[model samples]
Target: MNKIKNIGIGLLAVVALSMGSCSKDFLDEELTTKYSTEYFETAEGLEALTVSLYGNIRWHFGYEWAYGITLYGTDEFTNANDLTNEMWNTYDSRLGPIGATTSTGAANGNATSPNALWNEMYYGIASCNTIIANADKIDDEDVRNRCLAHAYFLRGYNYYRLTAQYGGVVLQTEPASGVVRNFTRSTEEECWAQVISDLRNAYDYFEGEVYTYGKGITWTKATAAHFLAKALLFRASERCDDWNSSYKQSDLEEAIDACSYAITARGGKLTDNYSDLYANWTGVDCDIEQLDEILMAAGHNADSSTSGRFGNRTYNYFTPQFSNFSGSWVKRGVWIGGMDFQRCRPTEYSYEVYDHVNDARMWKTFKTVYGVNNVADATAGIEAGDPGIVMILNTKDDHTYDSYTFGASKQAPNWTDDAGRLPEWTVGSRQTETSGSLTAETGQWVPNSLVLYQNGEYVASSFTSQPICNFFAGINKTDDGSRTAEKGDAHRDVTMARLAETFLVRAECYVRLGNYSSAMADINVVRARAEWKSGENRSYYSDGSQAFENNSLNTGSSAEKYIYSNLNMNTYYLSNPDLEVTTEASSLELTSFPSVLPDEDEAIMTAIGASSDYERALNFILDERSRELLGEWQRWETLSRTGTLITRAKAFNAEAAPNITAGKHELRPIPQTFIDGLLNDDGSNLTEAQKEAWQNPGY
Candidate 1:
């Protein structure tokens, strides 16, 4: 028998009593302790342990790039022409070609890199597991519970990210307890169950207001509920194959319930001015009052250490110069231009969705250089009458200038002679006239046409010069000179889980259940918000017909042509009233017209109110989701979950196969190293089933 010490080390250190080995009745002997699960006992110790869990939230370069690529790199949008490397390649929808080099999956040979995103997610899960296991031992209940809730939230979030990418993953709730830790992958249902349980637990512990870092604002129970609701909604959608097999209406009901809870609990309402939400990168001037819509955000600051510099760089890569910090370069002699990489360009499909005039979001999101800059200024010095010259002063004098053809008439303005003539000389003319040339001892002389002049003297001119104009018209710029701007900071925090989404979701549910009128009412709520005017306040069409009334334009051959054309005709018509139905315009035309497509409007309304309304509602929700959540990191998963990757592939004209075949590509491939290194030599003792199951479709 070993005697226990009276000194308090909590329950961590205890003596084990042996039955047969003891020689004396009350033998007292201290045996060296090998392993104990009771290491975290004190409040301070537990707090430190909990704080360590946050280290799991890392911002890896590859992970960030992948997330952005999977969403913005596809055909739905195009990269700005100037963006290059992985971004440009990906945006071209050459995934097989480029993903081979850039993607973290099996397409590349780097399926073994430790920094592969799969490893990061698992590592994050492990940290959460540690917090979950140790938090309960803390002396302070509040601290323990709070820490535990955060752990659960983080764990759920990580799992959500993982499951979204890899389908079902093994649910590990604790740290490795033995020399070997191996488990098979759980079913999608099982994984979602765990996620729901974790989120529910988190809700219980962190439902009340909790302060967030930087913003110092409290995330209420409503926020947690909103997150949970979004998760449930995604599950209900069952876009992922694993979940698709077992999707149920009950899941949608649960999602709706969660969203409703968030709305009611938080006194929920959409922020009145969506633009104000993202007006600044730092949260300094953000209206906390509008935070009800924003469930959570990865915070950023201008301070060096905390800023998301990479995110900012990525944003600058995609957005135009005028809408970003590069715009400030107008004051600097250096004029900024876009990458022209086509990686960040919005697709013709995406641009059409916006009701440009009424939607404030459109202007804030995109900048037509033609609209913002003086086209005359963009092609400034090259045009006739411009006093400036677009001469490239290079280090070495090895540049040449050629005469402009009739079609290419724009050229840099000729430099003035010593006499200070405005137009020094005309094209092809080298003679120095009295009025336009310098009068010197050696007769009239023109300033050296080949040399670049700064103040008045000739500087070296050696660099090549082309027309100083942007190929594409619109460009984005930073709000200020802040290079640390994030795309999230540029737009209104118009959340995806808004009241409109909920209504759409409910309408979808009702449609699925064949409840058309109920779904119609729900959808109408959203349309009403847009001010279409109903009943007594209803507006009529130009033909004195009610806007919603049926007509040949609404139900005939024109409707089919309109649907088939799908040329963003709405936006085109809005921007150009003179746009002939047959002829496409050379440039974007901004107009104020009243042209609305009856088919699309009727289809959307019918879908929202159809007997098969749920199906129609689903399509409508997805379409709207694409429109509303352009840069919100929703598209990839939405397409993946709904099995719409094929549709997207066709739309984007990607090199990928146009069918959603069941294979490794659907779920991302598990890194090969994880399989080789993390398993036993014989592979008999490892979680082989889980490992195999988690591999993506195309891998």
Candidate 2:
């Protein structure tokens, strides 16, 4: 075993072992050599159990499983080339009460099932129960209250996730001692109440101070308050219409107040630079978790030997297969541009949500240029340190090349064709009408793949003008070039909640209560930060890779000098007088609800045909969330809580639209493994009718 350096080292191993080996029961076992009732009676045991709860958060949010459940089947993304887990995104008939299994009848956890999330959350809840049960053993009042607060926050956090996906779940507040299978489900209303109550108690216990028990990665008062506000918002939403009549107005008011408190609590504020929040390229030395914007995060140490089992494997999911098309610019051995797992591909609506002309976030969030640094590109008449593949998110009409005209319409050339070679010259239509008619335009990008250029002539790709599966835009948020191996886990912490999201949450509350002006006030804060400011180099970009190679941010001490000092931030820029055109916009703020949709975004507008002012404002807020928090692992729940999952998915997501139903697709079916193991009060197997009743509707 690795040496224990962090707070969660002691009990996490035992929790993992218990969860992996025991599959018949739900959170039924807790085994440790040093753990006993007598040992738990001491202060050290309570502290260890509390720390293990934090570690359990890491276990729950690890790798692609977390992404599959939260991000897939939403409007923002669809299954990429790698369709190993396509059922999650497609919402086909295969997504049912019975979870996925191998051909040999063994349980396959993350392929197409929510069992992994279910087990991990319940296991963490078991640990939280242990801490709450034994916190009184500590003699120090302050220490006892701190440990209790941590337990309360984590328990509420787990239940919050559980109820969001599985509407009504088995709520167990006490630690399970043995295998007992006659559990019943709690109402969704009861579950949300528990979440709100626990989080409120946790906030009161923390005494209005931000606390960090681990390596600056534990929950604080602000974290608790943020969740509390989120819970209130969810309860007040249409999802809880069955029971939230009396508490709707009060919930909205309290939620708005909680958002205000969370914003100022513990010196929390949105970071001045939006890129600074995700610039975690220095492994454990990176101060991302310590930033004032972060409310809570799952800690992962840089040293794999001690960072627990799944050490930030999320770096592989959002990245596209860059090595397939831009092989000369990116190599597997030299500079692997993220692992190309290609799990989550951005939809057409995802790219269309941004104001590509004014929003700097679109450029910073997605990689559009692949600079060559290899000798192989010379064979294709390209020199080193030149752009090999440049993606234009606009239509050909905006970037027509006179040399490449076809029939009445002219074709747009790649970045090499523009004589100006200006950095801001990459403007064009988001997606032109495919047949030059309004009826034929789906708003999806046409001719998605580019024809390569060799010696100033077009070279046909392998797909013959079709958009290849492996060739798509890459997401820059999860980029981590600091890993030593191509497929190794990352060293950065997984961000869960932040101040910007808190502001958005408050804005959402305001929208729900018919306060459109206040909602826009909060939305403008984030939008203003995303605007391209004066005196800023518009071409200089870093998706956590350039920042690591050149240390352009001046991150660390002078001793650690990384390679590629020549690849400074401005290496990709070209001196052009027209660069100032990008800053011509006065502001990115929206003064009122958008009544008319632009031609490019007509598809999304048609999908959500809002007739009321309230619907228009709410839908606009949802789009703003997509613009700000894409691939942040919160899309599915946001849509589900707002009761817009079906409408939005039907409108934007091509794969999920046909299979999604109104009432059936909102909540995930309870895991069939757990349902099959249920017993009656007489200790007999549950009847088939009873089993069907226990499952979610339409499962």
Which candidate comes out best when scored by TM-score?
Answer: 2
lDDT of 1 by residue, 389-473 (tens): 1112211122221221111222212222222222232221111111121111222212112222234322321111222211222
Taken over the whole model, the C-alpha lDDT of each candidate is: 0.40, 0.64
Model 2, total clashes: 4
TM-score of every model versus the real structure = 0.61, 0.82
Clashes per model (N, Cα, C within 3 A): 50, 4
What value of lDDT does candidate 1 attain over all alpha carbons?
Answer: 0.40
lDDT of 2 by residue, 1-699 (tens): 001111122344444443332211111134244455456558977765665566666664556576878999999988776765677888876677775556523224447576667767777777677778878789998888888998899889999999999988887787555545335588899899999999998988887565544356457788888999999999999889988999989998998888888898746457776677773354454765578788877766544432335566777887655555423344332143367777887776787677666676765676655544444534444444344445444432233222432212122222123231223233221211121111111222121123222233322222111232445566767676566555656656678888888888998888888887888889888888888777454555555653345323334421122222112222112212223333243358766554543343444566688657677767877887888888888899999999999998988787788998888889998888777766666666767887788777889
Clashing pairs in 2: 394-428, 394-429, 394-430, 395-429
Give the TM-score comparing model 1 with the true structure, all chains together: 0.61
